[model samples]
Target: MSGTLRFLLASWKVNLASALEYRLSFFLLAGMMFVNNTIWLFFWYLFFARFPVVSGWEIGDVMLLWAVSAGGFGWASVLFGNFPRIATIVSSGQLDVYLSQPKPVLLNMLTSRMSVTGAGDFAFGLIVFLWAGDLTPRGCLLFACALLLAGVLFIGVMAIAGSLAFWIGNAEGIASQVFGGFISLTIYPTGIFRGAAKVILFTVVPAGFIGYMPIGLMREFDPGFAAAAFCAAAIFSACGALLFRVGLARYASGNAMTMRN
Candidate 1:
């Protein structure tokens, strides 16, 4: 366990160094992503200004929602960048390189890359949290827990979606669509949706686990719901790992030459 943790830390360090090698490009990409999130928040701000509340959610709730969602996503992407690109890697036989490594294939694959824009998303989340989220001791603690749960859930869902490549041959398109929809759903207040749509968010896409975190976990502290959300994240993560293992057995090798640093 210690060895694996060491490897993970080393991988992150290497990724950071590589990203810093091209500082100007890194800063530009991160900056653009931060601005992009701000613009979306601005639109939401305008809507809330006209109507102070939407389905019981105020702008403050939405701000924390983005904070948890974006912050969670950013940390996951920065640490395990390949979570979103598993389909492409599997379909292209990129698993060959990971298979050759002494480390666990999934862990190695996840840590092999880093996303520059993720830094922007992470920073944006922190800024938003400071601007609009609860600042009490309990509020901060709950928010931290919410961020962790959100990150775990995101990685788990992406892993499952990406593992489909082993069966479908080219599941990249499907994975992309699922990921896009998941992110889109997470920013909005779950209360806005009625019966079926609401059910779908919790069961099918599971975005409700994240969308409702601000209210259920941070703002009000619903113990029952928080427990459910925690279980949901754990279940999704375990399911993803199981699916990837099943799929890896059928992975095929390719003749294309490749190298990794």
Candidate 2:
């Protein structure tokens, strides 16, 4: 465990050094993200200003959803930026080096890229979250737990999508669509979705639990719902990890005979 932590820290340091080499570009990327999310918030504010309530959710409730989802995504992008690109690595036969290493490949991938720009998105999400506050101590605790679980889910989904590259050769387009679909779902109130749509969102896609469900529990002070969301997150993460391992066993190096870059 200690060795793994050390490797991760070292990797982060290397990534930071590389990013600093292009400081202007890094800050510009961060600035762009800030502007994008701020614009999204503005649109929502305008939306609520006109409608006052969508279904039963207010502007603050919607903001909470955005806060958790955007914050969760920012963390994922910062910590696991390489996840979505794993497909490219596999397709390009770049995963061979990772497979030859003594360390865990997944761990290596997780720590390989540290997106400094995601820090801006995280900061923006947190600011919006605080500004929309109705959080109790318990709500705060639950939110933290939910955020962690959401990150796990995000990584899990990315892994599953990336693993498909092994069979499909190039799955980047599919992965992009999948990610976009998930993000689109989280932008609205879950209450607006029902029946089969709700079931699919809550289970297969899980955009519901990413933000809506947890925020609902916080707003309503429902421990049972919170517990359910936590359990779902755990199960989803475990399933995702298991799926990745299955995919790894089936992975064939594009070049089996030589150690080539």
Candidate 3:
């Protein structure tokens, strides 16, 4: 466990160094994403200005929603940066080199790169939290928990979508759509979604669990919802792992040169 953790740290160090090589570009990308998110918030501000609340959600709730959504995605992208690209990697036969390595293929592929824009996302989350969220110790802890569950949900769902490449060739489009839909769903309050839509949010996509956390768990501290959220994350992660491992059996090699360790 310690060795794996050390390797992950080393990989992050190397990624940071590489990102630093083009410091200006990195900062520009991160900064641009931050600004982009802020612009969306401004639009929300306009809406709220006209109508003070939507489905019991005020500006502060929306702010926390963005924080959890972006922060969770930020950490996932920064750490396991390859979650959304798994289908492309698998379909393109790029897993060949990773398969030959002594380490875990999934871990190796995930940590191999860092997302420069994700730094801005992470920063935006913290900044929003400081500005809008409660700063008490318990609130901070719950917020952290929300981030963890959100990150896990993002990675797990994306991985499951990507692993479909083993059965269907070039599943990138489907994965991309899922990614888009999940991101869109997470930003809105779950209350706005009704009946079947709400059910699908929790079951089919599981975005509701994430979208609900800011209200049910983090802001209000509902034990049942908190437990449900944790279990959902675990289930998604397990399912993703199972699918990826099963799919690995079907991996086919390509023309790319690969070194065997």
Superposing all C-alpha atoms, what RMSD in Å does each candidate have to the true structure?
1.0, 2.9, 2.0
lDDT of 3 by residue, 1-261 (tens): 888899999988888888789989999999999999999999988998998988988888899999999999999988888899899889989897788877888888888878889888998999999999989999999999999999999999998999999999789999999999999999988989999999999998999998887899877889999998999999998898899989999998577654311
Best by TM-score: 1
User: Can you tell me which runs of candidate 3 are displaced by over 4 Å?
Assistant: 256-261
Ranking by lDDT: 1, 3, 2
Q: What are the TM-scores, per candidate, against the unseen true structure?
A: 0.98, 0.89, 0.97
Angstrom error of the Cα, residue 52, model 2: value is: 0.8
Q: Which is better, 1 or 3, measured by lDDT?
A: 1
- State the displacement of the C-alpha of residue 67, model 2, in Å, after optimal TM-score superposition: 0.9
Where model 1 places Cα greater than 4 Å from the true spot, the runs are none
TM-score, candidate 1, is 0.98
Off by over 4 Å in 2: 135-139, 255-261
lDDT of each: 0.91, 0.74, 0.90
Query: How far out, in Å, is residue 86 in model 2?
Result: 2.3
